[model samples]
Target chain A: MQTEQITETQKENKKQSTWRTAVSALLIFIAVPATIYLGWKFADRQHYIVSLLIILYSMVPFFLMYEKRKPQARELVVIAVMCAIAVVSRAAFIWAPHFKPMTAIVMITGIAFGATAGFLTGAVSGFVSNFIFGQGVWTPWQMFAAGIAGFLAGILMHKGILKKKRLHLCIFGGLTVMLIVGPLLDTSALFTMASGISWESARLIYLSGLPVNAIHATATVLTLFFFSKPMLEKLDRIKLKYGMMGD
Target chain B: MDDAFSGYHPAVNFIFFIGAIVFGMFFTHSAFLCASVFTSMLYYLLLMGRKGIKLLCTMLMLFFALSFINPLLNTQGDTVLFTYIGERPFTLEALMYGFVTGGMFVSVLLWFACYNCIMTSDKFIYLFGWCIPTISLLLSMVLRMVPNFKVKIMTIAGARKCVGKAPVNGDKKEKLQNSMDMLSVLTSWALEGAVVTADSMRSRGYGSGKQSNFSIYRPSVRDMAAGIIMLFCIVLTIICAALGGMEVAYFPVFILPEANIITILGVIGYTAFLLLPSIIHIWEEATWNILRSRI
Candidate 1:
C-alpha cells in the first residue's frame, strides 16, 4: 500500500512538472516575442514604456515558477539573507566609487542556491538598496540587469561550465557584468534620456558607458577572486546543516 | 509642515503619481513641460524644504549638461545656429528638443523624489502584497534583514577590534583582505541565524494556511473625491494627447500645435493634476491658521 501511494504521488508530481514546463515554454517562445512585436509596431516613439513592459513580462515566468514550488520558510529566509548581504556590502563599499560586491554576492547566491532564488536575491537587493540610495527612472532596468546576472550565474553553474574555482567564477562574473548588466543599463539611458534614437546616439551612449562598465566588471572579478572560495564553503556548510535549498 | 496629500489612501497617492509621471514622460509640448517642471519643483520643495536645495541644484546642473549634449550628438535640424568641429551644425530646433527632453527628465525625477517621501515601505507592501504575495513577503523579509545584518556587522567588528584583528591604516590589499574576512564571518553568522528564524516562523504556523495582510490605510471620502478628480484629469489629458492637441515636432523643423480651446484645456488639466498635492497642502495650512486664530 505504501509503495502504491508513493508511485501515485510521483506520477502527480511528474504531471505538475510537465504542465509547468509547457507554460514556461509558451511564455518564453510565444508571449515574449509577441510583446516585442506589438510594442515595436504600436509604440514606436514610446520605447521607454515598451522596454519597461518587456522587462516586467520577462520576470513573470520566474516568479510563477518560484511561487508554484511552495518554498519553505527556511528557503525564503536564506534568500532574504543573501539579498541583505548584497545591499549591506554595497553600502560598505561606498568609499570606493564603482566598486561594489553586489554582483559577486548575487552570483555566489546563484551558485549555492538555484536560478530562481538567485534572481530574487538580485532583484530584491537592486530594489531595496535603491530605497537607501534614492530611487530613480533607472530602477527597473537595474533590477532586471542584476536579476539576469544572478540567473545566468545559476544556469552556468548548473551546466557545469562554471565551477567553484576562483578563476572560473571571476571570469564569469566579470564577463556577465561587462556584457549583460552594463549594456542593459546603457540601453535604459539611451531610451529615456536621448532626444531621439539614432545609431550615432546609441553609439555615443554605449561608448560613454564603457569606462563605468569596465570598473564595475573589475569590481566583480576582484570580489570573486578574493572571496568566492570562503563564501562558497560557508554556504555549503549551511546547506548541509539545514538541508534547505537542496536543489 | 506635514503635507495633507500624503495622508490620503495609498491608492490615491499611487494613481496621482502614475498619472503625473506618465504624462510628464509622454508630453513634449512647451506648455505641458512647463506645467510639469514647475509643479514638480513646487511639490518637491514643499516635501523636502531646505534639504532639497542641494539635490535641486544638482538636477539643474544635470539638466543643463543633458540639454547641451543633445545638440552635439543630434545634427538633424535645418536651422543652423553655428558650425562646430567637423562642421557639425548646431540647430535651433535640436536645442529646443534638448530643452524639452531635459525638462521631461528632470520633472520625472522630481516627482520620484516626492514619491519616495510619500510612499513609505509599508504603503508599498500594502499596495503590492495582494498581487504578488511571495515577492512581497520576500521584500519585507529582506527589508527586515538589512538592518539586522548591519547591527550584527557592527557587533562583529567591535569584537574583532577587541581581538586586534580590526582593519587599521594598512595597504590596499590588507584592507581588502580584512573586509573580506569580516564579510565571510558575517555571512556564516547570518546564515546560521536565518535557519533559526525560519524554524521559528514555521513553528508559528507560517504556510499552514492562507495568509492575511494588515494595513493601516483605508480610503476615505476625501480620497474618493481626490481619486475622481485625478481620474477625470488623467482621462482628459490622455484624450487630448490622442487627439494631437499636445503635439510638437522638432526634427528637420520645429512645429507647435496651434493654440485652441482643446489645447488650452489639456494644459489646464495637466497643470491641475500636477498641482493637486500642493493645493491640498496650502489649503490645509490656511484652514489650520484660521482655526488657530479663532482659538
Candidate 2:
C-alpha cells in the first residue's frame, strides 16, 4: 500500500514482455535444474538438507524482484485463504490416497492472482498441511515442488496461454504435476533412503513411483479440467467486487 | 482433550520436540529410531487414548510400504533378496535402510502430532509471535481458518442438499455447476469476514502500537530444572553421536552397531531425551490419580 508505482510493473510482467518471459523460462528450465544437479553432485553426504534448502532459498529473490508493490492487507488475506483452501481441498479427498485438489488449486491461484501469490500459496500449503499430515524431512522438498509448479503457472498466465483455453490449462497443470512434482518427490525419497545415490537409482525411483505419480497427475487434470474455469471466474469476481488484490 | 502438559512451560515442549524430531532425523541408530516411534505412540496413547490407534495404523502402513519400496528402487548392497519385476535385485541393505528411514519418518510425525497438542496454534503463536509477527500471525490465522472453513463448506453442502442441488448427488455436469456455486459462496463469505477482521485489527492499532503480550505460562522451578536436564542430556547425546558410536552402517554392507560402554551411554541418553514427554505424562497421571484417591 505504501508503494503504488510497483504494481504497474508487476502487471506488465504478468503480460510477460519478451525478456521477462525468457527469464521466467530460464528460472524453471535452467536455474532450478542446475541447482538440483549441483546439490546432488556436491552435497552427497547431506544432500537431503542441502538440495532442499537451495531450492527453497532460490524462491526468495524471485518474490522480491517480481513484486511491484507490497501486497495489500486484503491481498495477503487472499493468498492465505487460497493456501487454506488448497490444504482443505486435500482433506476432502482423504478417502482416496492420491486423488487431491491441491495442485489444481495452486495453479489456479497463480493463473488468477499472480506468480508471487501462487508460489506463496503453494509453499504455505506444503508446510501447514504437513503439520496436519505430519512434518518430516520431506517437508522442504514438497514445499519447493509445489511452489515451482505455481510459479510456472504464473508464467503460463503471463504468456496468455493458460487463459487461451480450458484444455491448455488442464494440459499444463497435468504435465507439471506428472513430470516435475512426481520426480521431485521421488528424488527426495531416494536421497533419504538410498545409501549411495546415483542417477540410475533416481531413474528407478521414478519408475517405481510411476503408479502413484500417474494417479496424482490424472487427479490434477481431472480437477483442473473440471474446476479451474469456474474457480478462476469466482476469484476474478471477488477481486473486482471487493476492490481487493489491486485488480 | 485430556491435556497432560497444559500447564508446562512452552520452552519445555519446544526443547523436547527439537530433541525428538532432530534426533529422529539425524541418528540412524535402529534402537534410537524404535525408541522414538514407540515412546511417541505411547505418549499419544497416554494423552489421546484410543483416538491414537488410527494414527498408529497409518504409521504402520508407512513403515511397511517404505521398507518394501526402498529395496525395489535401490540396487546396492552385498546380500541380495529376490529380484523385482525386472533385473533390479532387492537388496537386504536397502531394505534395512528403508526400515530405519520409515521409522525416522513415523517418529518425526508422531512427535509433531504430540506437538500440535502440546503447543497449540495459540501457544505456537505465543512462542514466536513477537519475533516473526507477520508469518506467525498468518500461520495462526490459516490454522484457525482451515478447520472452520471445512465446517462452513459442509454446512453449505447440506444446505444445497435441501434444494436438491447437492454436489455429491448431482450428475457430473450438475455437480460441477453446483460445486462452483458453493465455491463462489465460500469466497464471498470469506472476503466479508476478512474485511471485518482487517477492521478489527486496525481498530486495535495492530500496526502502530508497541505490542505488549500477556502470557499465562510462568516457568516454575520444576520447569527450570527439567529444562536444565534436557539441555545436558542433548549435549551428551550429541557428543556420543559425533563420536561415531550410536549408528550402524546401512549401505554396501549392513553392519550392526557395536554395543559398548559409549554406545550404551548414548542409548540411555537417547532414550531419556525421546521419553521426556511420556515420562512427564506418566508422572502427572500417577500423581493426579493419587490425589483423586486421597480426596
CA RMSD of all predictions: 3.7, 7.0
- Top lDDT prediction, candidate number: 1
Q: For model 1, how does the per-residue alpha-carbon lDDT over A42-61 read when each residue is reduced to its tens digit?
A: 33246766666677777777
Identify the candidate with maximal DockQ. 1
Worst 10 residues of 1 chain A by lDDT: A38-47
What are the DockQ scores of the candidates, in order?
0.54, 0.23
* Residue A198 accuracy (lDDT) in model 2: 71
Which lDDT tens digits does candidate 2 get at residues A1-247?
5345457545544553445446556776777778666544433235554555566556645544433233455676677788888887754443346667788888888888877777777887887897787666677788888888888898778877667367898789879988899888888887665544676667777788999888888878877877777677778877787777664
lDDT of 1 by residue, B1-295 (tens): 3889999999999899888887777677899899999999999998888998998999899899889889988889999999988888999988988898789889999999999988877888899886567788889988888898888877867787776665442577776777778888889899888899999999998876566675888888999999999988888887777777876778789988589988998988889999999999889989999999998
DockQ of 1: 0.54
TM-score, one value per model: 0.92, 0.78
Lowest lDDT sum, 10 consecutive residues, model 1 chain B, at B163-172
Candidate 1, residue A136: Cα displacement in angstroms equals: 1.1
Model 1 TM-score, all chains together: 0.92
Model 2, B1-295: lDDT tens digits are: 6665656788888888867876666667777677788888888788778888998998899888877776766677989877757667888898887787677667777887887777665666678655444555567778878998888788878898898977666576676556656665666677668777766776766645234453677889988988888888898787787676765777799887669877888888878877777787788889999999998
Docking class of 1: medium
